[model samples]
Target chain A: MKELRWGLLAAGTIAAEFAAGVDESKHGVLEAVAARSGDRAAEFASRFEVPKCYGSYEDLLADPDVDAVYISTPHPLHGAWAIRAAEAGKHILCEKPLTVSVSEAEKVIEAARANDVFLMEAFMYRLHPQIRRLAELISSGAIGEVRAVDVAFSYNFATPRLTDPALGGGGIFDVGCYCTSLARLVSQAATGQDVVEPEEVLGMARLDENGVDEVAFGLLRLPGGVLAQLACGFQLTQDDHIRVYGSQGQLYVPKPAWIHEMRKPKTSQIILTPEGGEPEVIEVEATQGLFAREADHVAAHLADRQAPELTWAETLANLRTLERWRAAVAR
Target chain B: MKELRWGLLAAGTIAAEFAAGVDESKHGVLEAVAARSGDRAAEFASRFEVPKCYGSYEDLLADPDVDAVYISTPHPLHGAWAIRAAEAGKHILCEKPLTVSVSEAEKVIEAARANDVFLMEAFMYRLHPQIRRLAELISSGAIGEVRAVDVAFSYNFATPRLTDPALGGGGIFDVGCYCTSLARLVSQAATGQDVVEPEEVLGMARLDENGVDEVAFGLLRLPGGVLAQLACGFQLTQDDHIRVYGSQGQLYVPKPAWIHEMRKPKTSQIILTPEGGEPEVIEVEATQGLFAREADHVAAHLADRQAPELTWAETLANLRTLERWRAAVAR
Candidate 1:
């Protein structure tokens, strides 16, 4: 059996979940945990039964037993930690949004390239079999040529970090990136390319008093004539469904009303309704749940510099889209 | 029972549907049929058992037995025929999209006002119990404060009348009016007003070779801060849903993957998902069907010279939104 020793960076809630997921992952082990606060690091280490714990991120990065670091800090700090992890010669899996802007994401990508470390944005949903099966279903021409795509990942709760612009926050960075990522994936599946860029990005948002968008909506026209509608916010609870309209049929994920988002549950359902045909429900199961599967995915691709599900290039593209949407909204 | 005799002004498929609806209406009777060809008029009259058959619309308008006429002509001809019908002192039930443009709609409304005749645009869905109950639910704060509304009505088939601009066709005039109408209805319900206007109408479309939108999408910001997303066209088959997102809950119409559109069937469902609660399905049945209920609504409002469900003012407002969307798409 092969194992990739994992060190948890930033002892946050997400890092604790990742430690648990590594326990379930086939090719991963929770070797160490680290946080700026020594108490938090010790608490996480005790809870996860890790062999090592560190008060500083540098200690975790410098650990010889750790082959990879899962970066789950606030997006504002993701780039710095990921760069340090890369320079430390450890495989890096950073949280989504990568950074606040495209330039920062580019810098992080360059650092990863210069360090020659395995890197993948922690868009965990993309690595799940449910979404992989989605790409396969779309590419198989089951729904025909995709024309329109709609994705929403909005909720009603607002966290201090989510609404703080200085912390690389707001709806777009918080939940909207998931939407653009899904839209690009649909484009990738529809065009049979590695990825497709948006030709047009039109956005409208309701900004709070601090100039941070509380709710944001965007329409992206991809190169293949696909129009994707994205809605994300901290003020509204939407159905949060992924709807793909194709030339010959349509595909919808999850079920009637609930959304998958962070919860793929035991089985994921994709309803394919063909033109003049009945809806076919395709279900894909994640044996170890979404987070575990994501951890395993990183371990499986440790030998490679990037993940097939979400690559560094795609991460840069997704950041470009989020920036364009924000600029459009601000305009 | 009081009877408002109906003379269908066009021997078209929609006219036949209206004639059938009139048979089931409470205060309506099918009395006459009119078409350019006398044979077509006679055939429609005989098939529907209409006593009066006229070759010209003017002749049927002149028939004293016809108390009100259902103008089922293409939208390009709706204004002229509705004006003539009012001039001949006949109450009128015109089809959806009362006129090609807002100016045309206003002119027809002016004519109807000058003649002091009963006139209503036949948006049958508005007359159904399903939509009326939706208004009550929203007004009752069942879904809390409305923030976003999404409505789509799209189909794949492109008829000659739909593609020809001169005939008052294209997706905007053909089906997009319904989207705008639903948007206004939600706005009205949310604001507790008879109707509300859009503050901004931003639209994008995929124009065909003939400069007609094969598929159109719109984002409308209402006066009360509700953003509505509308999609309509002849190039795709959308779920054709009416989704309302509120501060505390969300409402989705029809069921799973199907849209009500013209088919109210026996019962219509509105799924209200309260925040942190299970979805509640509210079913409202229209015993007389959608079109028949529309006919009965007009029959019940003939003496008032207006309909409470959809007034000429709201019709004008809806048309203005559609025109603005089209102009935005063009720009």
Candidate 2:
């Protein structure tokens, strides 16, 4: 298969990480990078050893050598840039959350479908091998019909852009998206559905002076009587834990964020406790960085026209849930 | 202090445990045992080595030597027995749920107040030293203004009596009450209030053919934007874990049930994770069984008129929260 050429849409922190991941991937190459300033784009190109640098996203997208674009811009800018990339006939891997609201997500998805381009939300942690194994265990009925899921993703983050409502900043959009997505993923894995929608959603938030939620809690009732509890905040320190309880037993994953998988190979531990038995720890090694695996996954879709791990319908469902949660909390 | 004489009401499993704990206490003595049948009372007395046995609950309450009674009857019968014991001028330690509903709890409390007798719910887990230490840490702002609590108390309980709907057998009355009570306890500790009431509650459940909930989930919005997630079931195997997340850090107790503390001395572990720091495990050793601690606590209240660890107002608040949860799920 021909190697898929990549273009970095922003020279931000995440963009640098993606460039390194692209360099490490076996089926992808970094063709060009773009930033608002030419000097910043040239510096990123020099650091990642890319062949070309463009001062603007449009210039990079128009380059014939770039086959796909990775959008790492701020949350509010994702939809506009992604639609532009789709119009330029480039496949897109946009960072999470895909957009700030459900309507924006809908527009991005429609643009991708109309332009006949592949698009996936960059939820890199879902591409980790440990997550796949966990999903397999749930699908195999290791925990016998999941009844409830408890997820928490929190950190004491402080930044102007992160706390600014104008920048689409808040715990829900920043980190809570992971908790919601994982809940949906596990629900689908348990019930064998391509996508599962929450029947009911209740949410509470502690908002800052800037009208951004510093802390948020959400409860969702999924189909088949499955319940999920999610917590995300910028003011508390959570260990990034995820627990799924079922009729027969339960499984817990500490450090579900897979932080080490971003920069280097690492191992993750999953604790499985069966009814009337002791807890067993299962360790899974990811030999490749999560970003590289994600890149390869996108490459497979580009090469064979295979469906990406995250489907468009599922993305829309998740965004809608987020919108409902925000609405509930606002009331 | 003089030894407080005790009477065992209803020769059930919990009655036997309470009898043993009374025997182990330095300030309590088991004076009599009571059951509907004289033979059953005598059998329980022989097993626990009590001196006297009575055929009916009234006869045991009439005994002059029985200064306090431990009520261990089924859920639907607790209020009646406790009120009767209070009228007989005996201090009462009733098994948890306290009663099946909030109104019943109110009547029991009123009866005890009218008779000028001490009444305390036998939530033995609360008497464990680890729980006390955890409360102290929260009060000391170890976690800094508690924001959310995640609690689960589940087991595969399968007794005919436990599954009988007419007997008020269900996860909410049986196990979910613990989650609600703990949430309140931590909330009070955080806010330095004698009791805390949830502003809003939402619940969902999976009920069996008997119309008894086998699994239940609840979300509560407490004062000051604090939120709590609780899960309880008779169908799942949860290790009874409790996690409290706060502004500065979080704490997790692995074995929150502390059921084993009823008979044997044990050590419980609490993990405290400060913001941007490693988690530290704090171990607390219970020199005496939790039931013994409970017995001593009652003895202190009887001898010096000391207040019990769980107050009547707090118990009522917890029951009201449980009632709201049940009502929400029923809808």
Candidate 3:
């Protein structure tokens, strides 16, 4: 019931989207905004109506009024900013592809644990009401036993991002990570067992001139022989959709397929088609913004002095799969 | 053009479908009928108005009047029948998943070439007029530079025929093969090169009581990092659809998403969405039954004394991919 005071790091499109979510929230407040430059920070602050703006990340993290800092910088910078925010004694919410590499992710986690401050990956789609309801339906055998999962998050980002490897600009990091994360999340929920690391990973990626993956596809194998086929790209046009095929029926998430990109009404529909049955679509509306659910969940964890819903172990497992995939393509 | 004297190999569902295609063709004829029993062969002969009825495979192969034989038997027996038919100096049109394994497919190919006969893995869906148009469009840069391809072919084939491992029961071979084949075909056509073997194959499958794959998925990477994700199953219900995404536009073969499946008339359309432009959907009427185009193509190939439209080399490429996927699961 307590509103978590939030500080924004970086003034980019994603930062604005997250700030909008915070402003529309009932359990969170945009206490401040920050960027590398004072003018940019002030501009972002004015647009979002945040109470204060800071020219430096350290200044925002130091604000006594700020409880947590949401790090929305590029992939390479996520770890540094997260560790810095944690060191500053603020709880942290880092954007996805949490860090460009697994070692970087480890440093982020270490900083959070070392500082004893809450650290959560801002995977908003998983927190969306529709995804939770989907997990529920699959668990209830709505679609029968979980058999296969297909997840795709592709967009036309073939401009400057395709040419800049420094920004961690490519499909695997920018979009494929979401596909892989969702697979792990849904697999774990469906099997009622932690979705195990894929025994073998076969990844293929189109490397841009900058040597970053522009598009990638992967096959993940779960414990029960469940297969998740994930495809993502920054150079292709796409309709973001995630489909889980179970024995009884299927659940189709219409849009905002990932955790963070929450759509209005804050929900997606579950399409269930029972045997010899017609397809039924049901929409689920969540009580909180998908981003806020994690924030709320993290707050509750902080209040109870417990770990977040997704444990550090799960985070490590997710990172391992990602690292293996990246290594596969790099080779 | 020379007429193709076709022998109907079985009286099963697919055989009946092929008979209908021959019956409606101008350049092909049902010259012979073959089955395990004389009575069944007679019945098939009567139904299709064929000139000859043979009680056994040997008798049918010995019929010098038959110019070509269509092998519509179970997957496990495909190699044997195809090889036998080839040894008898007849061209062949074997059902999809050319043979259960690539090793077997190699033998079938060897036999066909030794006899200097036309041979084709009968993936009828690819020959559908709409599919041809879609492929042509993509090759013509109608969708601009292709980026990603997604294909799904699932049907609840948990029936008695599909439940038997002897019949190649399960989704991957039964249905998933089409998905993978389409992925490869589209990728090859889009990239203007032989589709490369995916560097790594990742897959998941639901095992049947017989320990064969029941529901399966595969993600593949071809050269240029083109990513193809495929989902297929016998347990999760049935859906046949293929979508090709490119830079300028996208083409959806709404019908016949799988090989040999009949696409309903006029339901196929190519949606062209150029960069910074609106989408245009061009509807194509089904020219005839899905098998008609394959029948015509085969007829043409035979007349020209050339290899099938989808050559032995292409079939070999497809079989290799299928073998790796099955091996990944079987291991």
Candidate 4:
């Protein structure tokens, strides 16, 4: 198989994890690491055992050897870096909340389209086998006429970069994007459509002193009368489960995000309960880590211009919903 | 203990359940039953082994042997019958919602006050030991500064009474009441207040052909910025779990509604996961069925004019919120 050489755009925690994932991928190789400071970039390269390090993002993007770039910068910097990478003729796997707002995401997509490069949002959990099976079951009517979805994703981990307003930091942009994306994915699967947008959006948030939301809740009314209730927070510890309710049965994933799926081998269970019947547990065995699968998916898209796991239109729809939710909570 | 002679106000499915609960209660007796038809009333009386059966509601209200009334009629009839029962100098346990609207609930409360009688809405799940323990834990800060609640209570069972407009049918008035009541209960527990109402209410619903909502979703913003997302439907089957997210930890009740707690012995579990810690499952043994507990609670209040499990103000607040939700969805 042809290898896709990857350049790490930021020496952050997630970027480090992505590098580890790339190391495990059969069709991807972490070729370079980049940071604002030379020492940080060199340290990251040494840690990851990459061959090259760049003192600045522009230098990494300018490297002809870098076949694809993973934009793992802070939430606010994703748009500018993704556009620059696309302009430099490199495929892009941007970390989630692809940009902080819809307009920024649109610009990134436009840039990618204009430059003829592969651009996909790095929503690694969607590449997991369990989530794929979930979508398949919903589409196949395992639950029968999906009507509602409830998701709770929250954890009590706080840092200056996560809570600072200047950094575009908030639960909505950090972890809430996952909830929004999952809602859209399930709605699309149930409707068998390419895209779904919420007809109505309502949200509330608990903002910290820095004017960034620590926790947030959102409700969406999708087409075909599906109601999605989502809760995301950086201030609480929750079970992080996703439940899909349908006319005949229900499906539950104990760990919908599967955050631990990237670190080690983990077994996940999908519980299906038909109306007035016993619950059936379907256990899924982990083969490749979630991020590794994501890396391979990105490599395939880069090789043949195949469709990304998350399309550009779907990402824009999710960002639009997120913008509306932020506005609702602010009001 | 002095037994309170209970009169069954309707010969419906719920009414039968209440009759069996009264029979099991230590301080309540199933004395009489009434139905629109004489034969149905007689049949219910025979099955429950009651001594008296009345063809008309007026006859049962006028009977001197009836010490209290359990109003188990359809949703729309609850207010009128509750007011009549209050006027007849009988203590009342009215099935939820206490009334179809806030105005009707107020009238029923007014009548109860004027007649010096006990009045309570039968939110049976709240009377269960597991729910009571949940409330205690929240009030004691077991989870620490509760911030959000997500509840799903749905089942795939449709009947004329559930889907017909004339019967005051809908998912919201039937099962939705349970979700709304649980949200309020948990909020009140977190805030340590006797009453708490959502500052903002937003909802969406899928109305069936009769203009009755088969499925409904509501979002509430309670005091202290707590967000509650509730979904109820007659068109689907769900896990029917209640999750409370807090700043320090999380608490989850596997069966929040405890719908099956009335029929047989069941042990429910509450899973608590503190920040960065493993979840601890607390198993609670059901000493008395939920309905039996409700029957005993009503009997105790009737004997001493003590407060009922669900107070009139709390019921009014819940109804008012439900009214807002209906209006929001209609808009």
Q: Give stretches of model 4 more than 4 Å off.
A: A263-267, A303-306, B263-268, B283-286, B303-308
Q: Candidate 4: interface RMSD in Å?
A: 1.6
Write down the lDDT of every candidate, Cα atoms only.
0.83, 0.85, 0.76, 0.85
- Write one digit per residue (lDDT tens) for candidate 4, span B288-328: 76777788888767754535457788889889988888777
Off by over 4 Å in 3: A1-3, A158-163, A194-196, A257-267, A286-301, A305-308, B1-4, B100-116, B159-170, B191-204, B207-211, B223-225, B257-267, B275-278
Could you tell me how far off, in angstroms, the CA of residue A173 lies in candidate 3 after the best superposition? 2.7
Please tell me how candidate 1 rates in CAPRI terms: medium
Total clashing residue pairs per candidate? 0, 0, 12, 0
Q: Name the best candidate (by DockQ).
A: 4
Each predicted complex: what DockQ?
0.55, 0.55, 0.60, 0.64
Pairs with backbone N, CA or C atoms under 3 Å apart (clashes), candidate 2: none
Q: Evaluated on chain B only, what are the TM-scores of all the candidate structures, in order?
A: 0.96, 0.96, 0.91, 0.97
Candidate 2 TM-score on chain B:
0.96
Which pairs of residues clash in candidate 1, taking residues 3 or more apart in a chain or in different chains? none
TM-score of each: 0.93, 0.95, 0.90, 0.95
Q: Across residues B59-164, which tens digit of lDDT does each residue of candidate 1 receive?
A: 9988989888999888889999999999999998898789878898898999999999999988887777778888889889988888888888889888898888
How close is chain A of candidate 3 to the true chain A, as a TM-score?
0.92
